[model samples]
Target: MSDLVDQLVAGALDRVTAWPDGALARSSPPPRSVLPGSFNPLHDGHLNLARVAEEMTGATVAFEISVTNVDKPPLAVGDVRTRLAQFAGRARVELTRAPTFVEKSRLLPGVTFVVGADTAERLVAARYYGDEARMIAALRDMADRGCRFLVAVRADGAGRVRSLADVAIPQGFARLFTPIPESRFRTDASSSAIRAGRRAAP
Candidate 1:
């Protein structure tokens, strides 16, 4: 991690210092919540999500990178640093390496854990955590600690956002924000698209 992002994550970690697990003093208290994403190349859409998340919760955003996902393929360790550079000084955010969504979910008690609609849907997949019940229970535990959820609408092929109203958010998971129609930014860029060495950007 870049020294800058390390500082940022440290700052964000300070917010939950009171948790029994202890806090990193260097971290800042995230004003709103975190909008966790792979942030591969950190595209405009991700930036828009951060802005919208701030508007909704009145807090700074943090970008989370999953380490477990990185080992699966072409993404290098330096990718986080590269993506972090894209947002430097533009926002009071930092990059973190979270091995699992559940582990990251515990980082900031009471903060909103932002995710894409597809990810929100996958939270209940049977393969997650080897059982669906444990996943649900874990989310509930996070909620009990003040952690909430925010989901962005998934963009359809036409670049239109699908409705998130019917998405099944587990009980106690409060919706802190939704993607504004105006905040939509379309891109064909994704990790899969980028791995092909094409014009992929996420």
Candidate 2:
């Protein structure tokens, strides 16, 4: 367990501060639907997926923020609160110290994570963990914890798009993921892309 996770999970009261429909929520058991991201600025692309994910799985939907970003500085509590406010009656949100999917599975056991094909692809890749054995071990751990994944299509460069089927998941872990067809949930809108466009605009 990491320092932040220890502080947040110590009291048996919370997995971290949570907000459901703009109101503070009690620390919960395994989450139903979890869309994990930085969510620097929540956008419609996220909302579209969340709505669809909830409908498809018939599970509660919530956005999850990892204060311990992979590269950036940890986010302030106020910043996290401000972002959660944006959901405002639209959805629930969670704040956590877990950065990678492996960590998230431990924190949000039995969760059905919503991810794009790009992210799902990375899950089986070795570079992310620097070795294939470690990656497989981590994924197996998630499965053992009863966590699963929902993957959607995403636009690649040159306007090309890839679907869940496009990702070559490992054989043993294939059952742990569900694919949403492109027709069902495809989106080119991304926060990073949006920021880049704004930066380039005159």
Candidate 3:
């Protein structure tokens, strides 16, 4: 990792260690809630989610940019630095490359994990891991440790969103925010779109 990226991650780790439940030794204190993503280039949706999460929970939001996407190639360390700069001190957002879901879970034991509808569907679909129940169980365990999840709704091609009512939120979520319908910000820029440099990804 580049020095700057390392600094950002270290700074984020410091903050995480300072939360009410943050005890570095035990790895038990639920750090501030985390919104982990690749963020090839931070976008408005991310900013919106951070703002909305703070509005809904009144807690600092941690923007975790993990380097562990099996589907996509990893981003350069400098890219991580640039993105961190983009989010510095915005509603208690912290940027870091988590590298693994387990690492992320361990780092933010008592915080909420933000994701989208597609990830949520995979969390329960046996086809993805052949043990949907195991995935659910793990997430529940994290919640039991004071960690939970906040799943946001992503827009479809027609500017529609999957309602929160459509998904089953397992027990133990620290807090749950309603899915933001497509009517609020009908964005078309996604991370993929940003990477492709075609139109823009929402």
- Candidate 3 colliding pairs: 21-29, 30-110, 188-202, 189-200, 189-201, 189-202, 190-201, 190-202
Estimate the lDDT of model 1. Answer: 0.56
The candidate maximizing TM-score is 2
lDDT of each: 0.56, 0.80, 0.56
lDDT, residue 26, model 1: 38
The CA lDDT at 157 in model 3 is 52
The candidate with the higher lDDT, 2 or 3, is 2
Q: How does residue 50 of candidate 2 score in lDDT?
A: 89
lDDT of 1 by residue, 12-60 (tens): 3312211112222335554447777666666667777777777777876
Which candidate should be chosen as best, given lDDT against the real structure?
2
Runs of candidate 2 with Cα error greater than 4 angstroms are 1-14, 199-202
Candidate 2 clash pair list: none
Model 2 C-alpha lDDT per residue in residues 1-202, reported as the tens digit of each score: 4343345434333356455544454456656889988776788888889889988999878889876768787766567667767877676677777889998898888999999988998988988998988988998999999999999999976787877788888879999999987777888988888878888999
